[model samples]
Target: MLNPPIPLNEMDRLLSLSDLDLDYAAHQDSFKDLTKLAAKVAGTEMSLVNLIDSYTQWTISTHNLELEQMPREDSVCQYVLMGDGSFEVEDLSADERFKDKFYVTGGPELRYYYGIPLNVNEHNIGALCVVDKTKAKELNPEKIELLKIIAGEIVNRLKYIKVIEELKSNLSEAKQTQKKVAHDIRGPLSGIIGLAQLISAQGEDNQMDEILEFMSLIHKSGRSILDLADEILSADNKKDKKTPELKGNEFNLLVFKDKLDKLYTPQALNKQIKFTVNTSLASETIPFSKNKLLQIAGNLISNAIKFTPVGGHVIVDLNLITIDEVQHVLQMRVTDSGVGLDEKGIATILGGTASSTNGTGGENGYGFGLVLVKHLIDSLKGTLNITSIPGAGATFEVNLPQ
Candidate 1:
């Protein structure tokens, strides 16, 4: 028995096939209708949409036959990938290439075959084929033209599936990020309230110096929060700018560090947890989105303070390390001495699921903060590492490009 020859562009063809991420099971009905139409038009007993990969011929869709997959060397449709047009065999018994094959000689004793290459992105990855047990002369010039049109439709459907899959993924990411940003606003708002209470108490004692300092910090934090909210609202109102929240701009890291310290210090002191923000930096100016960094760092510090018991320490260490001559990476580490995470709890956090647990001070959380942090890290093309023991402590390390 003669086997089908491999195409010269086999590597590229397989790569393109895998990139489609085709889920044949989900779209079986779509392919089934097309294959059914091809068989009806060609007056054949069976039809197949066979996708050829490195070693297997996958029957993604079929009509009038029950088939799944087979070796590439044993597939009659593999030969269609060698040319740019249809491959037809009027009588399998008379053709040397497939005359002694299983389907032709033993299984179905198929005598007629007509196939069109499924072309996409300058590659023929598969074939749309029809087969019969008799040497049929039913595929006229008009019928062949109709079959080619159907072949184009199959490729179009594949392209549509890729587009839809991408859209769904982008939509999901946007929704998750938005939720994280909304939750982040609560941090600064709480800080604002704390500062106001402090100012009122200082006013009764006529401590103008401290009151003025607190007012300055409040103004800056309020402006930053407003800017973040405006960006989010603009992105929602403007359908074109779907991801404006991720846009980057130049900002001073020192200013950001001060805001973070002011925001979390009161909360930590209220809980009797020692919160320290340590920074070792060669440059304070970083070309990255300030709001995104704020959200990431805010969530980490908040979680640390929440989990640590009274008299425990929660430290935030930040530094800029050289990645190359032209690039630097911002490394932020948050460590806490409190009830740490087990392996299962770590998995739930990293898996982007909500895992609710009460804090050492009985503080409640939505449990999606870590999930949001992970998604934001991925979006920034950064890395996150977590280390913890059940009762000792936990440390979260994040490195982002600047």
Candidate 2:
């Protein structure tokens, strides 16, 4: 069998090097401890922790290259620039892998080199490369294993930096978005509410009907403002909840069916949509968070009210399915008659992406509602399932352990 040649372009890309990467590439720029660690592992006097950018290599940890960054073309660790498993040159001057690679042999009497790529993702920033002045030494399995482990430690630190970068970006965006949405909605909402109050105080007349219409508009606008505020607040308070104390538990969906009815009543009234809350499960409750149950129900019902066309219907139901002869699961569904979604929309909501779409009254949000739904289900150690056709409404099923 012939071997397939790796594309040179893709092969050279190594560890994750974000604009926020803190790794200094110069051997002189690295801390003394790291330089010492590198030197010790390579049994060399010039071990270096190198990070390569497009034009130059930075020395992060090094024993010999103190205070000076080598050029990209002259970097022996440039081989580490590849995200491939690892690069080792037993004798930099003799090995075919890098013998003609002038950077490895031309500088510092370097006769040997070995490097491990520090890839955090597709971003290949650089390598933990080592060099020596003596004859190439054979490294056994144990020695190679230890080198890889040290490389992992370096990568772990890099990953923490990367995550902090991502979180900061997400946080900033969340706050700004909440601010703009809140500001835009608040002015009109307050005006409508104030005017409604003034009309209610007017002297009574056949104007009662006109006043009532104003009152209804005010109420709907007020609800919209409230919902917007809730969403904004929720984003700002992204839950940093300590892991909940987990224990054996159960939630009763059958008995909870009636409670679901009470909750969906307002939604039905507002949308003019008929909703049925029914149960088929023998065991209404499953082992899960009692409070999370309410949150799930509230979100689903609220969403139905927002999307279901006027005069359409929504049904909430639960059923028991035997997983095995001895085990059963409580299944609950919230089905609504409304604008149906395409396959991509379903995937976004179901595949852990926040998909937003405009609601019945031109209320805009991600078409994806199942993000929260899926998260809540996971928190309860349960499962979520969804099915929808483009024209038919969506059905969401929450399966809980009994």
Candidate 3:
């Protein structure tokens, strides 16, 4: 059913290979002219120099209504292979070998057939099949000699097309290489961006305020570089070729919350905002990479700080939850008591999705962080959730299996 019976007339299926050459001619300059010359020289309605493969007969050049290609079993060229010289059927229906063939009855009602094999340099590529609906003009020795000469030129064209395709492939590869280089550089570039922000925000002041700003820059820039590097390195795994090793370790949520409070202090001061960290659960330990865990916290904390207004308070609470009725989890709630996010932002943060938007202070970041955070949490067998009021603030919760 891949190629349901392509009905060609006796001549169409026979020399109607003309369409093959015509269709492909535009694609390759090497074989195009040869097909046209083969048709004109034979004075046929359709003609083609074909390349017979295992299952299909393809044309290098074609003229008239012949097909671009057809199944070898269905091809008139397949029948022509039985003879040495041009296989000529002045009238196919009257011929014993072909009268029973489907094409003579309901298919492209082919009546006349003639094809001169184009074997050259040990390659039996195809034939210069000159076909017509009416009886073909009887070929004399002179015409047969001319057919041989024309077929030779067609072979030369095939060689040229092969070379052209090779060149096109090389050009495509080079372009992809250039695109990959640009994509790889985005990671390191983010580091530079963070450094630049620290310097600019400092405004030539070597004061404690400027140094703290610089430190926050280092934190953000370092995390961004690591995330980018991780993605670049894990791309092979993401492509389904390998499994990524899960990375985690034992750490305290209380201490982690304290670090966030300190890191976000500069941000809070800059916006004249109040930042708070509160927890009612017992301070316990859990297994997860501290550095990566910090990033997950940093991304959420930074986002909270970014959206929170001056004098507005951001509360971070660690809640203990039971998981699988077997163990306990130290879930962290980072809630910003300022302007909240839309449903879309909540989905992105919880689901690790995407969008393009600058922070409140014109801070630019690739929203891919949320996506990475989601993958990391899942890798650690954890669930993340986000809740928010339009003008109040947002609350993000992380639930992990103990």
Candidate 4:
């Protein structure tokens, strides 16, 4: 028997199939009645809903015969996937392509066959086929039309399954984002609580200026926390596909640097990595999204520290250049002396694929932060440049409009 020709878009078809994660057996009930109707309409003894994957032809649902899953090379359904419409053999034993010694010659002595490709999202993934032991002169036109309609229904069911799968995947990603948001808020919240504790401990013994300074810091940090909630953690943003508004507020560079120092200094120390920050800005307060900057800086520095080996150095440089009266370009560079990424690792990060890698100091991290950083940069209409040499060091430079 002749083998089936492979489709030109085989790689893409397989990728689409993998994303569906189709298990026809698990969803057999959905197609059982349809398969039965298809067999009865086409006057065949057996009918099947078969999916051809990279390695196997899986009969997800069957009528009047046992469910058979065989290697793709051995299954006739593979031929249907290569075409856009139905395929037929009036007598299997009469056709060279299908006149095999197994089913066609001895087992069930299958004679007649008809099948239509099951197309999903423009890719022919499988087939809806009917087989009979008796030979037929020709296929009935009316029956073929009815079978095509049934195949369409089957395709609809597959589309529904795909939608459900996508929703589930999106829900999972949302949960992960929620966890990261909570983790992000924890740092500023802890600083707030610590400031409160200090004010309580000093009581009336502290001077008015000292108390006012503590209160001012608390207010700035509190505003930053609120901004995180309103922007990053908003429920409305999730429902809509548009980018979240990166609103500009009067942001203090000194405060931003202080916050980063408070959050990452101890983390660096714990890992025995030296951390340093240098700033050269036109003004202490500028028009920009403080929360977005914090996210961009926090994710970069944390990743730098995580990947930096013991005794290595992580440095962040903040430089702002005034362009016009209303616009300023803030350039932030994060450099790390760590185990840098190879080409594959860089490609994976740039592709926005979530992956986990063990750090140089043995810290474990899912690369979600890098993905978030990319998103924020894109939302701000900014640019990011990366340069790295594996086993030596890496640098991440971001230029954002303020």
Candidate 5:
């Protein structure tokens, strides 16, 4: 005979609780102990906790039995879900409903059976059952009550597992977010420190105008750092918050170049590497987030300088390209003659694997810089392309709508 059909309403609830599709068999020790306790309390030789889905019956916990699963059509627990409470079969071989069943006639020769439905969120999903080969008397009232209580405990344990899994997932996400924030902030903070030190060592003969300009740049870098920190904190607190409005400031190309020059010139000079910048943009001002743009540019340029040999060259090119005779796009390209990336390295880095290595100058790198740059470009709705040849160089091209 075919198995009894599950009610549509209960099936819907079972589908909704998909997160409870756990492999309880992998954690057999605790569940085996529960099954043992259950068998002793109910005075049964064989007891098991079985989770019944639409297609199969999975035995999560079992005592005095080696059975693990069976087809739902052959499951004895199917009858248990048909009622509001515990179900019992005093003699399966004599019962007309199961006398011809394979489990009764050929498998386990099951005769006496008793089961309590395991319900979760009003859905009858499984059962805690006990079976025996020999015909046994009907369960006493006290044994039936004990089986019901054990079933409730099993349901509670499943709920607890679900909660613990969610907490672990959240904690993993929090750690990744923290790592990203730290990686992004490091570039700008280094720039601020370097620029401040340059301003301090200029001595008494330093020109007043140059001193003021340096100080202004320092202030801007400090504010940018604070803004980044605030944004990260806000994201953590309000996960469902809508994306904030883009804060656009008038970005001057000359000022942008000056900042890059201050940040990378010393490093390039110390390595005796040639550094060059070429621009073809006619516009002086653009509306964009200065700090975010700086981070993208600074990170790429720093990586170029760090990896380039003493005689190698690093180049930055900027241009404004008109698209479809209407929209204008800013194209920035950074090319470096350094220890380039092979296909595997490029895939690992772009895939956010967080791989790290030392540069040519023995300068350490966290390997998260390119990952952060890619994330920033995505936020700006920009496109980035990478071209590289091992032992030759790598080129990064970025295009953003104006």
Candidate 6:
């Protein structure tokens, strides 16, 4: 026999629901009680909660039935799903559609079949059914109504399971976010505390000019820590409230360059690493989110400084390139002469596996920075490419539409 045709929209909805993947047969105890109640209420000897897939009809819960699954072609529930109301066959042997079916003509000789479709997510994917061996009389109005009520209960349980699963997934993601925040702030906080201690040790014994310089370094380190905290808190708040659409704001390239220089030049000098920034559009202003851009650039530069060995170099280049001769793309590239990544390390970092590694300067990192950078780039509708050769260097290129 041919398979029954399913409506396109119904099929789409069935595929989207998480309940379809649930192995209801494995946890059949609750449903087994439901089937028993259904049978007792409807005055039937056998009851089943049947789920129909592409080619099989699975009995998730059954009372007085031996089989767990049968071919979908032999299923009465398939016909039940064709209607919004219950399907009732008072005498299966007298019905033309089921008379020749093996279950009717062969063993058990089912004579009565009644099924109410179970609707979930506005789609009927299964049925609550009752069957009997002896010819049975037509169901009364009260019994039919009770069957429908039980089917509705099954649908509610499916929805409840879906909600619980979603909550669990969200909680897991939130915990990971907290871990990432702690990881990203560690290096900057260490710098702040270390610089503050240096300023305290130099009290009164240092020359006035030297004292002023050390105090400036301490202030800069403290601001870096604050900026990192602010970025994390802002991201969490947006997520908690459901992220709103971002709007473009005026971005000054020269101001951005100055911030980058102030932020990393001292750290580079301390480590004896060459740090340079080259921008072709220094005086130009662009429409972009300045804070988001700063977050991405800051994380990249910080990671580069941490990984690059002494005597190595880190370079940042910003320019505009024409694409298809009709649009300009803003290109920002960060290149570093660091201990470059192997394939395994690259996969672990970019895939958000939270792998931690010690940097060239013994700086500890949890690998969340690159994951955040990738997410930010995607939100901007941009592309990021990383090129690396082990023991040589690594380069990260980002392109955003302008």
TM-score of each: 0.50, 0.36, 0.37, 0.44, 0.50, 0.46
Candidate 3, poorest ten consecutive residues by summed lDDT: 1-10
Write model 5 residue lDDT over 150-222, tens digit each, in one string. Answer: 8888889888876775666567566658857866786777677667756756633566677767676786777
lDDT (Cα, tens digit) per residue for candidate 2, span 14-33: 21242333423212332456
CA lDDT, every model vs. true structure: 0.76, 0.61, 0.60, 0.74, 0.70, 0.71
lDDT tens readout by residue for model 4, 286-379: 5354536755676688788878889999999887778887688888899999999888877776665636565775544433568767766887
Off by over 4 Å in 3: 1-36, 55-62, 66-75, 79-86, 89-94, 102-111, 118-121, 140-146, 157-159, 187-402
Q: Which ranges in model 1 have alpha carbons more than 4 Å from their true place?
A: 1-3, 23-26, 195-402
lDDT tens readout by residue for model 6, 293-352: 655776687778778999999999877675654466777899999999887776765664
Q: Which model is ahead, 2 or 6, in terms of lDDT? A: 6
Residue pairs that clash (backbone atoms under 3 angstroms), model 6:
none
Top model number, lDDT: 1
Give the Å error, residue 191, model 5: 1.6
Model 4, residue 185: what's the lDDT? 81
Stretches of candidate 6 off by over 4 Å are: 1-30, 93-96, 99-109, 203-402
